[model samples]
Target: MEWAPVCAEGETYANKCMADAAGAQIEYEGECENYFTKEQAQIAAKKWLEEESPTFKFDGIPGSIKYIGYESYTCFGCFGFTFTFNSSHAGYGNRSGQMLAQAIANHTILVQTRGKNVSYALTDGAFDELRQIFICPAISALIPVCGTDNITYPHPCPAMQAGVKIAYEGECQ
Candidate 1:
């Protein structure tokens, strides 16, 4: 909880909308360029500048998010962070359940850095800080992919970032 001081008192939120995936086409305002690997980030940025958009999406490769665009980057860095979007903040409660499912399928995320290596934990509280200040703005700056199969925009939208699989039990009716 390194960024605990920097983050707002409440960072996690519960859905107040729906239990299905989002169907509305929410377009990101700018572009999202992060690298789970340095080389890939470089490559993505280059392509983004030339093409004018980040096309990175999560590949359904266990812990992989897909990156797409009209171009490429010099490098995507090294994988060590789990990326996710906090839907509660996005105000997609009605579409929560479905969005969660789509997120699991896409798995887009960026690599967390530590000085010069991948730390993979929110030690400095970068994630929390981003949640309070950076997340929504970041999403607003990028384009949201239509389907939840790939990681679009800033990636791993807080709504559906990659993380440990949650174990759920059937509700007793």
Candidate 2:
């Protein structure tokens, strides 16, 4: 007997494969919600952080974790959430200063605001590097250098290393 595909929303498909391809839950009988709870969001964020850097420690307070809510921007609908807390860097030598170190350790959860889809992955490439930039105290002292992309770098050296052209001195602001 051929089995028909039934989605959580009671939508039927031609076949199980087709329903699966459409991102529908196969043989799922429970109700589905389009929203995620704060707890669920926290778990997703934590899991992503762990996967990214196993040694990284999130030294946030007991109640520091929160769901800052979501906003729509861009094609995939970017949603942002953050958890503020001090991070512990017992093993890795502190590259960024204490203030920047703490900030770097903090968790910034970014996700696509799609229905019931929680991506536990840091999709932003510059996130890690930008966080490091915040840690560099020399950034304030270094002359601002503009790259070919119009991004302001703390120093010309970094701009050159990043393979970007220096437009001018002084911060990119």
Candidate 3:
């Protein structure tokens, strides 16, 4: 059965009719953003990673992939997702020993629809306000850090990329 949420109270009903009976205005489709889980985040990232790999040339092998952290933003008919992950393939290359070991980077993907077409993309620079939104640069040192938000960032760069303040030298407590 399809479910609907009374967003104001964070309540979910079996269906829209049940929600309407409760005199609650339907917020939107599916679960609220806070309900999104780490597993779902990894699934979204993996799906897009597969679909965009040909164009993006991602070299990470399947078993070597690990998700560090993610953030999702939703509005009206559009959504944006940002994730930081590591792959044994090492996203950045520097011809040095450690540099060739692993790669940590942030990737942002967006969803938007116009008419009947739905697009999942790295960025939509078409809009003036979104010009600054971009995939973080592919280069990063292997320095992992904890952000003030209590999330572990692969490195300070990705934490900065997400605008999260660095809290310390290692994983969050």
Q: Which candidate number would show the highest lDDT if scored against the true structure?
A: 3
Candidates 2 and 3 compared: the better one by TM-score is: 2
Q: What is candidate 2's local distance difference test score?
A: 0.45
TM-score of each: 0.19, 0.34, 0.31
Q: Model 3, residue 118: what's the lDDT? A: 31
Q: Encode model 3's per-residue lDDT on 120-172: one tens digit a residue.
A: 44432211112232245565566779998899988776775565667799877
How many clashing pairs in candidate 2? 2
Off by over 4 Å in 1: 1-104, 115-134, 138-173
Residue-level error in angstroms, candidate 2, position 107 = 6.2
Instruction: For each candidate in the order shown, give its overall lDDT on alpha carbons.
Output: 0.29, 0.45, 0.46
Worst 10 residues of 1 by lDDT: 4-13
Better of 1 and 3 by TM-score: 3
The clash count of every prediction, one per candidate, is 62, 2, 3
Q: What ranking emerges by lDDT with the best candidate at the front?
A: 3, 2, 1
Candidate 1 whole-model C-alpha lDDT, 0 to 1:
0.29
lDDT of 3 at 66: 41
Give the worst 10-residue stretch by lDDT in candidate 3.
Answer: 124-133
Worst 10 residues of 2 by lDDT: 121-130
